[model samples]
Target: MAVPLLSVAAPAPHLIGDKAYDADSLRYWLAERQIKAVIPSTASRRTPYPLNRRIYRRRNVIERLFCRLKNWRRIATRYDRHASNYLARVALAATVAEWIK
Candidate 1:
Protein backbone atom coordinates (compact mmCIF):
# COMPACT_ATOMS: atom_id res chain seq x y z
CA MET A 1 0.00 0.00 0.00
CA ALA A 2 2.74 2.45 0.91
CA VAL A 3 4.70 1.58 -2.22
CA PRO A 4 1.74 2.26 -4.51
CA LEU A 5 0.78 5.40 -2.64
CA LEU A 6 4.33 6.78 -2.87
CA SER A 7 4.48 5.93 -6.56
CA VAL A 8 1.31 7.90 -7.32
CA ALA A 9 1.98 10.94 -5.16
CA ALA A 10 4.35 13.71 -6.23
CA PRO A 11 7.85 12.93 -5.02
CA ALA A 12 8.60 14.28 -1.59
CA PRO A 13 12.18 14.89 -0.41
CA HIS A 14 11.57 13.12 2.89
CA LEU A 15 9.31 10.33 4.12
CA ILE A 16 8.62 9.87 7.80
CA GLY A 17 7.23 6.58 9.09
CA ASP A 18 7.08 4.42 12.20
CA LYS A 19 9.13 1.31 12.96
CA ALA A 20 6.69 -0.82 10.95
CA TYR A 21 8.22 0.72 7.83
CA ASP A 22 11.80 -0.09 8.86
CA ALA A 23 12.42 -2.63 6.14
CA ASP A 24 15.69 -2.46 4.19
CA SER A 25 13.89 -2.91 0.87
CA LEU A 26 11.62 0.03 1.55
CA ARG A 27 14.57 2.19 2.56
CA TYR A 28 16.42 1.23 -0.62
CA TRP A 29 13.34 1.91 -2.70
CA LEU A 30 12.94 5.36 -1.13
CA ALA A 31 16.64 6.02 -1.68
CA GLU A 32 16.24 5.13 -5.35
CA ARG A 33 13.69 7.95 -5.61
CA GLN A 34 15.93 10.29 -3.58
CA ILE A 35 13.52 10.32 -0.64
CA LYS A 36 15.12 10.48 2.79
CA ALA A 37 13.57 7.79 5.02
CA VAL A 38 13.10 8.89 8.59
CA ILE A 39 11.90 5.58 9.94
CA PRO A 40 13.60 4.11 13.00
CA SER A 41 15.31 0.76 12.74
CA THR A 42 13.57 -2.36 14.00
CA ALA A 43 15.25 -4.41 16.78
CA SER A 44 15.95 -7.22 14.32
CA ARG A 45 18.36 -5.14 12.27
CA ARG A 46 22.01 -6.11 12.83
CA THR A 47 23.25 -2.55 12.59
CA PRO A 48 20.88 0.41 12.76
CA TYR A 49 21.47 3.61 10.89
CA PRO A 50 21.71 6.86 12.82
CA LEU A 51 18.26 8.37 13.19
CA ASN A 52 17.51 11.99 13.97
CA ARG A 53 15.60 11.82 17.23
CA ARG A 54 14.75 15.52 17.11
CA ILE A 55 13.01 15.16 13.77
CA TYR A 56 11.36 11.90 14.84
CA ARG A 57 9.91 13.70 17.87
CA ARG A 58 7.85 15.83 15.51
CA ARG A 59 5.77 12.74 14.67
CA ASN A 60 4.04 13.14 18.01
CA VAL A 61 2.25 16.26 16.74
CA ILE A 62 0.66 14.31 13.90
CA GLU A 63 -0.13 11.41 16.23
CA ARG A 64 -1.83 13.73 18.69
CA LEU A 65 -3.79 15.41 15.89
CA PHE A 66 -5.08 12.04 14.70
CA CYS A 67 -5.96 11.15 18.28
CA ARG A 68 -8.00 14.30 18.56
CA LEU A 69 -9.78 13.62 15.26
CA LYS A 70 -10.59 10.05 16.35
CA ASN A 71 -12.32 11.44 19.43
CA TRP A 72 -15.21 12.32 17.10
CA ARG A 73 -17.36 9.21 16.79
CA ARG A 74 -18.38 9.93 13.20
CA ILE A 75 -14.78 10.23 12.05
CA ALA A 76 -13.50 7.31 14.15
CA THR A 77 -16.16 5.00 12.74
CA ARG A 78 -17.05 4.62 9.07
CA TYR A 79 -20.49 6.14 9.42
CA ASP A 80 -20.19 7.70 5.96
CA ARG A 81 -19.80 4.99 3.31
CA HIS A 82 -18.77 7.23 0.43
CA ALA A 83 -15.11 8.31 0.18
CA SER A 84 -16.05 11.91 -0.66
CA ASN A 85 -18.34 12.16 2.33
CA TYR A 86 -15.77 10.50 4.57
CA LEU A 87 -13.09 12.93 3.43
CA ALA A 88 -15.44 15.86 4.03
CA ARG A 89 -16.15 14.56 7.53
CA VAL A 90 -12.39 14.34 8.16
CA ALA A 91 -11.85 17.89 6.87
CA LEU A 92 -14.71 19.15 9.04
CA ALA A 93 -13.32 17.36 12.06
CA ALA A 94 -9.84 18.80 11.43
CA THR A 95 -11.30 22.28 11.02
CA VAL A 96 -13.24 22.05 14.25
CA ALA A 97 -10.25 20.62 16.09
CA GLU A 98 -7.98 23.39 14.85
CA TRP A 99 -10.51 26.08 15.80
CA ILE A 100 -10.83 24.61 19.28
CA LYS A 101 -7.05 24.49 19.61
Candidate 2:
Protein backbone atom coordinates (compact mmCIF):
# COMPACT_ATOMS: atom_id res chain seq x y z
CA MET A 1 0.00 0.00 0.00
CA ALA A 2 2.79 2.42 0.98
CA VAL A 3 4.94 1.40 -1.96
CA PRO A 4 2.65 3.25 -4.33
CA LEU A 5 3.14 6.42 -2.31
CA LEU A 6 6.91 5.98 -2.37
CA SER A 7 6.80 5.60 -6.13
CA VAL A 8 5.29 9.04 -6.59
CA ALA A 9 6.65 10.80 -3.51
CA ALA A 10 9.71 13.00 -3.71
CA PRO A 11 12.99 11.21 -3.11
CA ALA A 12 14.21 11.06 0.48
CA PRO A 13 17.51 9.92 1.96
CA HIS A 14 15.93 7.74 4.60
CA LEU A 15 12.76 5.71 5.23
CA ILE A 16 11.93 5.28 8.88
CA GLY A 17 9.39 2.76 10.12
CA ASP A 18 8.55 0.52 13.06
CA LYS A 19 8.97 -3.25 13.54
CA ALA A 20 5.81 -3.92 11.50
CA TYR A 21 7.71 -2.72 8.46
CA ASP A 22 10.82 -4.79 9.13
CA ALA A 23 10.60 -7.13 6.15
CA ASP A 24 13.49 -8.33 3.98
CA SER A 25 11.56 -7.55 0.79
CA LEU A 26 10.82 -4.01 1.92
CA ARG A 27 14.42 -3.51 3.05
CA TYR A 28 15.64 -4.72 -0.31
CA TRP A 29 13.16 -2.47 -2.07
CA LEU A 30 14.37 0.53 -0.11
CA ALA A 31 17.96 -0.49 -0.81
CA GLU A 32 17.26 -0.51 -4.54
CA ARG A 33 16.00 3.04 -4.20
CA GLN A 34 19.09 4.03 -2.18
CA ILE A 35 16.89 5.07 0.75
CA LYS A 36 18.37 3.93 4.03
CA ALA A 37 15.82 2.05 6.12
CA VAL A 38 15.82 3.09 9.77
CA ILE A 39 13.62 0.17 10.82
CA PRO A 40 14.97 -2.21 13.41
CA SER A 41 15.10 -5.94 12.68
CA THR A 42 12.44 -8.09 14.26
CA ALA A 43 13.64 -10.32 17.14
CA SER A 44 12.75 -13.56 15.29
CA ARG A 45 15.06 -12.78 12.40
CA ARG A 46 18.21 -14.91 12.33
CA THR A 47 20.59 -12.13 11.52
CA PRO A 48 19.37 -8.73 12.60
CA TYR A 49 20.22 -5.86 10.34
CA PRO A 50 22.33 -3.13 11.91
CA LEU A 51 20.27 -0.12 12.91
CA ASN A 52 21.18 3.51 13.37
CA ARG A 53 20.08 4.02 16.93
CA ARG A 54 20.18 7.81 16.64
CA ILE A 55 17.88 7.90 13.64
CA TYR A 56 15.54 5.34 15.18
CA ARG A 57 15.18 7.49 18.28
CA ARG A 58 13.84 10.34 16.12
CA ARG A 59 10.73 8.25 15.40
CA ASN A 60 9.74 8.74 19.01
CA VAL A 61 9.43 12.49 18.45
CA ILE A 62 7.07 11.93 15.55
CA GLU A 63 5.03 9.50 17.61
CA ARG A 64 4.73 12.03 20.41
CA LEU A 65 3.68 14.74 17.95
CA PHE A 66 0.86 12.53 16.66
CA CYS A 67 -0.18 11.78 20.24
CA ARG A 68 -0.40 15.49 20.93
CA LEU A 69 -2.33 16.15 17.73
CA LYS A 70 -4.82 13.41 18.54
CA ASN A 71 -5.50 15.16 21.84
CA TRP A 72 -7.63 17.64 19.92
CA ARG A 73 -11.19 16.25 19.89
CA ARG A 74 -12.03 17.78 16.54
CA ILE A 75 -8.88 16.44 14.88
CA ALA A 76 -9.21 13.06 16.52
CA THR A 77 -12.86 12.77 15.46
CA ARG A 78 -12.32 14.16 11.93
CA TYR A 79 -15.14 16.64 12.28
CA ASP A 80 -14.17 18.63 9.19
CA ARG A 81 -16.06 17.59 6.04
CA HIS A 82 -13.54 19.08 3.63
CA ALA A 83 -9.93 18.03 3.26
CA SER A 84 -8.73 21.63 3.20
CA ASN A 85 -10.57 22.39 6.42
CA TYR A 86 -9.08 19.33 8.08
CA LEU A 87 -5.62 20.36 6.96
CA ALA A 88 -6.19 23.86 8.27
CA ARG A 89 -7.23 22.44 11.62
CA VAL A 90 -4.14 20.24 11.70
CA ALA A 91 -1.93 23.24 10.92
CA LEU A 92 -3.63 25.20 13.68
CA ALA A 93 -3.22 22.32 16.09
CA ALA A 94 0.42 21.90 15.24
CA THR A 95 1.02 25.61 15.75
CA VAL A 96 -0.74 25.50 19.09
CA ALA A 97 1.21 22.43 20.12
CA GLU A 98 4.51 24.14 19.32
CA TRP A 99 3.46 27.37 20.92
CA ILE A 100 2.61 25.62 24.17
CA LYS A 101 5.91 23.75 24.14
Candidate 3:
Protein backbone atom coordinates (compact mmCIF):
# COMPACT_ATOMS: atom_id res chain seq x y z
CA MET A 1 0.00 0.00 0.00
CA ALA A 2 2.72 2.46 1.01
CA VAL A 3 5.00 1.37 -1.84
CA PRO A 4 2.45 2.48 -4.45
CA LEU A 5 1.90 5.77 -2.62
CA LEU A 6 5.65 6.39 -2.51
CA SER A 7 5.86 5.71 -6.24
CA VAL A 8 3.08 8.23 -6.97
CA ALA A 9 4.05 10.88 -4.41
CA ALA A 10 7.35 12.17 -3.06
CA PRO A 11 9.00 9.60 -0.86
CA ALA A 12 8.77 10.43 2.84
CA PRO A 13 11.84 10.47 5.04
CA HIS A 14 10.02 9.12 8.07
CA LEU A 15 7.07 6.72 8.43
CA ILE A 16 5.04 7.27 11.59
CA GLY A 17 2.92 4.36 12.84
CA ASP A 18 1.37 2.99 15.99
CA LYS A 19 2.74 0.12 18.02
CA ALA A 20 0.64 -2.33 15.97
CA TYR A 21 3.03 -1.68 13.09
CA ASP A 22 6.13 -2.33 15.24
CA ALA A 23 7.41 -5.52 13.65
CA ASP A 24 11.06 -6.32 13.00
CA SER A 25 10.50 -7.17 9.33
CA LEU A 26 8.57 -3.95 8.70
CA ARG A 27 11.31 -1.91 10.39
CA TYR A 28 13.95 -3.67 8.30
CA TRP A 29 11.97 -3.02 5.13
CA LEU A 30 11.61 0.69 5.97
CA ALA A 31 15.35 0.92 6.74
CA GLU A 32 16.17 -0.82 3.44
CA ARG A 33 14.17 1.88 1.65
CA GLN A 34 16.09 4.60 3.57
CA ILE A 35 12.98 5.60 5.51
CA LYS A 36 13.07 6.10 9.24
CA ALA A 37 10.33 4.27 11.14
CA VAL A 38 8.90 6.40 13.93
CA ILE A 39 6.98 3.47 15.39
CA PRO A 40 7.51 2.61 19.01
CA SER A 41 8.45 -0.92 20.01
CA THR A 42 5.77 -3.28 21.30
CA ALA A 43 5.81 -4.30 24.92
CA SER A 44 7.05 -7.82 24.08
CA ARG A 45 10.21 -6.60 22.34
CA ARG A 46 13.37 -7.67 24.17
CA THR A 47 15.15 -4.42 23.49
CA PRO A 48 12.94 -1.38 23.14
CA TYR A 49 14.33 1.46 21.10
CA PRO A 50 13.94 5.01 22.36
CA LEU A 51 11.38 7.11 20.49
CA ASN A 52 11.32 10.89 20.11
CA ARG A 53 8.30 11.87 22.17
CA ARG A 54 7.95 15.19 20.38
CA ILE A 55 7.80 13.54 16.96
CA TYR A 56 5.38 10.87 18.18
CA ARG A 57 3.01 13.54 19.42
CA ARG A 58 2.42 14.60 15.83
CA ARG A 59 0.66 11.30 15.18
CA ASN A 60 -2.29 12.56 17.20
CA VAL A 61 -3.33 14.82 14.33
CA ILE A 62 -3.52 11.88 11.95
CA GLU A 63 -5.44 9.85 14.51
CA ARG A 64 -7.95 12.66 14.92
CA LEU A 65 -8.36 12.94 11.16
CA PHE A 66 -9.20 9.25 10.95
CA CYS A 67 -11.60 9.67 13.84
CA ARG A 68 -13.38 12.45 11.99
CA LEU A 69 -13.50 10.48 8.76
CA LYS A 70 -14.91 7.48 10.56
CA ASN A 71 -17.82 9.60 11.66
CA TRP A 72 -19.06 9.45 8.07
CA ARG A 73 -20.97 6.19 7.67
CA ARG A 74 -20.04 5.60 4.04
CA ILE A 75 -16.33 5.88 4.74
CA ALA A 76 -16.46 4.01 8.03
CA THR A 77 -18.37 1.15 6.43
CA ARG A 78 -16.29 1.26 3.21
CA TYR A 79 -19.21 1.48 0.79
CA ASP A 80 -16.89 1.90 -2.19
CA ARG A 81 -15.60 -1.41 -3.48
CA HIS A 82 -12.93 -0.04 -5.82
CA ALA A 83 -9.71 1.37 -4.44
CA SER A 84 -9.89 4.48 -6.62
CA ASN A 85 -13.45 5.22 -5.53
CA TYR A 86 -12.60 4.65 -1.89
CA LEU A 87 -9.60 6.95 -2.13
CA ALA A 88 -11.71 9.60 -3.85
CA ARG A 89 -14.28 9.48 -1.09
CA VAL A 90 -11.58 9.75 1.57
CA ALA A 91 -10.08 12.76 -0.23
CA LEU A 92 -13.47 14.39 -0.47
CA ALA A 93 -14.18 13.75 3.18
CA ALA A 94 -10.82 15.21 4.21
CA THR A 95 -11.32 18.27 2.03
CA VAL A 96 -14.79 18.95 3.48
CA ALA A 97 -13.56 18.41 7.00
CA GLU A 98 -10.68 20.83 6.49
CA TRP A 99 -12.93 23.39 4.85
CA ILE A 100 -15.43 23.20 7.69
CA LYS A 101 -12.69 23.39 10.30
Candidate 4:
Protein backbone atom coordinates (compact mmCIF):
# COMPACT_ATOMS: atom_id res chain seq x y z
CA MET A 1 0.00 0.00 0.00
CA ALA A 2 2.76 2.42 0.93
CA VAL A 3 4.74 1.71 -2.22
CA PRO A 4 1.81 1.91 -4.65
CA LEU A 5 0.13 4.96 -3.13
CA LEU A 6 3.44 6.78 -2.84
CA SER A 7 4.29 5.90 -6.41
CA VAL A 8 1.17 7.57 -7.80
CA ALA A 9 0.74 10.53 -5.41
CA ALA A 10 3.26 13.32 -5.84
CA PRO A 11 5.63 14.97 -3.36
CA ALA A 12 5.14 12.22 -0.79
CA PRO A 13 2.21 12.69 1.53
CA HIS A 14 0.99 12.34 5.04
CA LEU A 15 -0.20 8.79 5.68
CA ILE A 16 -2.90 7.72 8.12
CA GLY A 17 -2.93 4.16 9.38
CA ASP A 18 -3.61 2.43 12.67
CA LYS A 19 -0.89 1.51 15.13
CA ALA A 20 -0.14 -1.59 13.05
CA TYR A 21 1.96 0.50 10.65
CA ASP A 22 3.53 2.55 13.43
CA ALA A 23 7.14 1.52 13.52
CA ASP A 24 10.39 3.42 13.94
CA SER A 25 11.56 2.50 10.41
CA LEU A 26 8.25 3.45 8.80
CA ARG A 27 8.17 6.80 10.66
CA TYR A 28 11.75 7.54 9.62
CA TRP A 29 10.91 6.62 6.01
CA LEU A 30 7.89 8.91 5.96
CA ALA A 31 9.83 11.71 7.65
CA GLU A 32 12.61 11.39 5.12
CA ARG A 33 10.10 12.35 2.45
CA GLN A 34 8.46 15.06 4.58
CA ILE A 35 5.19 13.18 5.10
CA LYS A 36 3.20 14.35 8.12
CA ALA A 37 2.16 11.17 9.89
CA VAL A 38 -1.10 11.14 11.81
CA ILE A 39 -0.50 7.61 13.07
CA PRO A 40 -1.22 7.19 16.74
CA SER A 41 1.28 5.99 19.27
CA THR A 42 0.91 2.40 20.34
CA ALA A 43 1.23 1.26 23.95
CA SER A 44 4.68 -0.11 23.16
CA ARG A 45 5.98 3.19 21.85
CA ARG A 46 8.84 4.43 23.98
CA THR A 47 8.53 8.12 23.03
CA PRO A 48 5.48 10.35 23.14
CA TYR A 49 3.78 11.04 19.80
CA PRO A 50 1.41 13.74 18.70
CA LEU A 51 -1.71 12.99 16.63
CA ASN A 52 -4.76 14.84 15.38
CA ARG A 53 -8.02 13.90 17.03
CA ARG A 54 -10.14 14.97 14.06
CA ILE A 55 -8.30 12.63 11.70
CA TYR A 56 -8.50 9.71 14.12
CA ARG A 57 -12.27 10.05 14.22
CA ARG A 58 -12.42 8.96 10.60
CA ARG A 59 -11.28 5.48 11.61
CA ASN A 60 -14.84 4.72 12.60
CA VAL A 61 -15.74 4.54 8.92
CA ILE A 62 -13.42 1.55 8.45
CA GLU A 63 -14.92 -0.15 11.49
CA ARG A 64 -18.35 0.34 9.95
CA LEU A 65 -17.17 -1.22 6.68
CA PHE A 66 -15.98 -4.27 8.55
CA CYS A 67 -19.31 -4.56 10.36
CA ARG A 68 -21.10 -4.31 7.02
CA LEU A 69 -18.96 -7.08 5.57
CA LYS A 70 -19.59 -9.30 8.57
CA ASN A 71 -23.32 -9.23 7.84
CA TRP A 72 -22.69 -11.62 4.91
CA ARG A 73 -22.61 -15.17 6.28
CA ARG A 74 -20.36 -16.38 3.46
CA ILE A 75 -17.79 -13.73 4.23
CA ALA A 76 -18.04 -14.27 7.97
CA THR A 77 -17.51 -17.99 7.48
CA ARG A 78 -14.93 -17.78 4.63
CA TYR A 79 -16.99 -20.30 2.72
CA ASP A 80 -15.50 -19.42 -0.66
CA ARG A 81 -12.14 -20.94 -1.49
CA HIS A 82 -11.47 -18.85 -4.58
CA ALA A 83 -10.44 -15.20 -4.25
CA SER A 84 -12.49 -13.91 -7.20
CA ASN A 85 -15.65 -15.63 -5.96
CA TYR A 86 -15.20 -14.18 -2.50
CA LEU A 87 -14.54 -10.69 -3.85
CA ALA A 88 -17.60 -10.87 -6.12
CA ARG A 89 -19.82 -11.87 -3.20
CA VAL A 90 -18.42 -9.01 -1.12
CA ALA A 91 -19.01 -6.58 -3.97
CA LEU A 92 -22.59 -7.72 -4.33
CA ALA A 93 -23.21 -7.28 -0.64
CA ALA A 94 -21.65 -3.83 -0.64
CA THR A 95 -23.75 -2.79 -3.65
CA VAL A 96 -26.99 -3.91 -2.05
CA ALA A 97 -26.11 -2.21 1.23
CA GLU A 98 -25.37 1.00 -0.63
CA TRP A 99 -28.67 0.80 -2.45
CA ILE A 100 -30.55 0.41 0.82
CA LYS A 101 -28.63 3.32 2.33
The candidate that achieves the highest TM-score relative to the unseen native structure: 1
Pick the winner on lDDT between candidates 3 and 4. Answer: 3
Order the numbered candidates by TM-score, best leading.
1, 2, 3, 4
Q: Output the lDDT of residue 61, model 4.
A: 77
- The 10-residue segment of model 1 with minimum total lDDT is 49-58
C-alpha lDDT values of all predictions: 0.90, 0.91, 0.85, 0.80
Query: What is the Cα-based TM-score of model 4?
Result: 0.68
Using lDDT as the measure, the top candidate is 2
Residue pairs with clashing backbones, model 4: none
What is candidate 1's CA lDDT for residue 80?
Answer: 96
RMSD of 3: 2.2
**Tens digits of per-residue lDDT for model 1, 1-101:** 78988899999877889999998888999999999998999899899977888888888988988999999999898799899999999999999997897
Q: How far out, in Å, is residue 97 in model 2?
A: 0.8
**TM-score to native of every candidate shown:** 0.92, 0.86, 0.85, 0.68
Off by over 4 Å in 4: 1-14, 29-36
Regions of candidate 1 where Cα sits further than 4 Å from its true position: none
Candidate 1 positional error at 93, Å: 0.7
Clashing pairs in 3: none
Model 2 clashing-pair count? 0
Error of 2 at 73 (Å): 0.9
Model 2, stretches more than 4 Å misplaced? none
Q: Write the per-residue lDDT of candidate 3 for residues 7-91, one digit (tens) a residue.
A: 5666688888899888787778778989888889999999997787888899998998988998889999999999999999999
Per-residue lDDT for 1-101 in model 2, tens only? Answer: 66887889998999989999998888888899999999998989999999999888989888888999999999999999999999999999989997896
